[model samples]
Target: MKIAITSVGQDLESKIDARFGRAKWFIVIDTETNQHQVISNEHNLNISQGAGIQTAENISRHNVEAVITGNCGPKAFTTLNSAGIKVYSAVDGTVAEVLEKFKNGKLKQAGGANVEGHWA
Candidate 1:
């Protein structure tokens, strides 16, 4: 499975970013081979509006199967759901730690957005 974790930096050792839409980077890891890639979310970081939706759309293009993040808003959640991507919210710790938790089935899938839209 391909999982994308919101990260504060480019590497797995980097801490997980608490804000999904405004996260600095996305660490996309393929569970099968342990290969990964980093995607920057710089464009959405300073956007005044539509950041969540835009971020969601951008992630969808990467073909990630799941997203692990600290928070998610309704619009972004809806967009991801429509694209057939699962969301695991309210997560913390380093990107590597979170990835391990996910692989071990320790994380819970979020049923809906955990926070309101326009969250910083």
Candidate 2:
């Protein structure tokens, strides 16, 4: 499966960014082949508003199956859910660490947005 992990930098070694919308980068990885790519979220990182919705739209375009992040807001969560993308919340540690947890089925799946909009 292809999963996107919110990251502080471009690589798996980078720390996971807690905020979904304002994350610096997203590390998209394929679990089977172990291939990966980094997508930057520079535009949404400091937007005056609507960052979560915009960022969620951008991520959905990548066709990622799931998202790993510390927090997700209402608009973003609703948007992602509409696209059939699963959101995993309260995730921490490096991109690699979370990937491992996901692979092991240890990460928690979020039922709904855990934070309010414009949270970050």
Candidate 3:
């Protein structure tokens, strides 16, 4: 499965970003093939306001199966859901660590949506 882990930098060694849609880069990791690519998030701040559509489209383009992040706002939650991508919250630690948790089925699914203006 293709899992996207939000990271602070361009590599998996970077610490995990607290927000999903606003992360600096979405580290796309392919579990089966062990392939990984980092997708730059050009609008970490603005995406929260009006780029949900674009973020959803970008994620769809990657054929991502699920997203692992520390937080996801309500708008993004709905947007990602509509795009047929599952989102799991509370994924802390580095990008690689989070990916391992997800692969081992240990990452917790977000119990609720985050409030707007919570990330900043």
The top-ranked prediction according to TM-score is 1
Off by over 4 Å in 1: none
Tell me the lDDT of candidate 3.
0.77
Q: Rate the local accuracy (lDDT) of all candidates.
A: 0.95, 0.91, 0.77
Candidate 1 lDDT, tens digit per residue, 35-109?
999999999999988888999999999999999999999999999999999999999999999999998999999
Q: Which candidate comes out best when scored by lDDT?
A: 1
Q: All candidates' TM-scores?
A: 0.97, 0.96, 0.85
Error of 1 at 112 (Å): 0.1
lDDT of 2 by residue, 3-90 (tens): 8999999988999999999988999999999899999999997888888888899999998999999999999999889989999998
Per the 3 Å backbone cut-off, how many clashing residue pairs does candidate 2 have?
0
Clashes of each: 0, 0, 0
**Cα error, candidate 3, residue 41 (Å):** 1.0
Evaluated at residue 46, the lDDT of candidate 3 is 71
State the local distance difference test value for candidate 2: 0.91
What candidate 3 gets wrong by more than 4 Å, as runs, is 44-48, 117-120
Superposition error at 52 for model 2 (Å):
0.5
Work out candidate 3's RMSD over C-alphas. Answer: 2.7
Winner on TM-score (1 vs 3): 1
